[model samples]
Target: SAVISQKPSRDICQRGTSLTIQCQVDSQVTMMFWYRQQPGQSLTLIATANQGSEATYESGFVIDKFPISRPNLTFSTLTVSNMSPEDSSIYLCSVGGGAGGTTRNEQFFGPGTRLTVL
Candidate 1:
């Protein structure tokens, strides 16, 4: 199992402003994922970050709006470029265990940063 951390756990920002959320893991992980959850809704995959490569974003999400950086095996950052009411959601960071039958195969998530755009 991996432990994940996120910064600025919750914040209120103005429209058109941006916010950068940081994610750190306790151990090495092959892949790091970013997600967004609207109030009372399920998590939506935003992007995947792998060390040494550009992040792959989901459809409707772009690098310019949601840039991701994976600097090493246990750390990554995601930036929300322009804040909007629509972007006011819970952003999460997660890592999954692959090829293992243990809980490592399950995805462990950070405490998620809740953002509110005014």
Candidate 2:
């Protein structure tokens, strides 16, 4: 199993500002994924951070807006480039788990960094 943590459990920011959240894992993981959960909405994959490579972003996300960095196997960071009330949501970092060669890949989420854009 993999454990993850995100910084700034909650933050209130003014519009036009940006915030960078850090994620740390207790163990080495092959794929580190970032997600965003809007109020009353399901989680949306932001990007997948593969070690020693550029992050692969999902549909509707661009690197300019949400830049990601995976410096090593156990650490990564995500930065929300610009601020807006619409951007307010809970950001999460996750990793997969399980046994055998098959990736049992269950996403273990952080408590989430709740952002409130004012």
Candidate 3:
């Protein structure tokens, strides 16, 4: 199993500022994804970070606003650009479980970075 951790457990940022969240995994992973959980809402997919390629952003997200980098299988970063109060949410990093077990479709998530834009 892979253990995931995120930096800066929580933060308060001024509007118009930005924050970069880091995700690190103990083991190498092929598929790493970013997600946002707004207050009282379900998690929303932000993007899929793949090594050696650009991160694929979800429908409602754009690369310019949420740039992502997957330097390697064990590390990835997500930057919230020009953040606004609406961007306040819990950001999470998730990695798909390795194959060959009942863990299919299973994913491991980081503790999450809670951000509040004021």
Report the lDDT tens digits of candidate 2 across residue range 30-104.
Answer: 788899999999999999888889999999999999999899888889999788999999999988744212267
Please provide, for model 1 over 4-93, each residue's C-alpha lDDT reduced to its tens digit, 9 standing for 90 to 100: 899989999999998999999888887889999998999999999998999999998999999999999889999998788999899999
Question: Clash number for every model?
Answer: 1, 0, 0
lDDT score at residue 109, model 2, on the 0-100 scale: 73
Residue 89 alpha-carbon offset, candidate 1, angstroms: 0.3
By TM-score, how accurate is candidate 2? 0.92
**Candidate closer to the true structure by TM-score (higher is better), 1 or 3:** 3
Model 3 pairs in collision = none
lDDT of 3 by residue, 20-82 (tens): 999998877777889999999999999998888999899999999999989887899999999
Give the TM-score comparing model 1 with the true structure, all chains together: 0.93
**Model 3 vs. true fold: TM:** 0.94
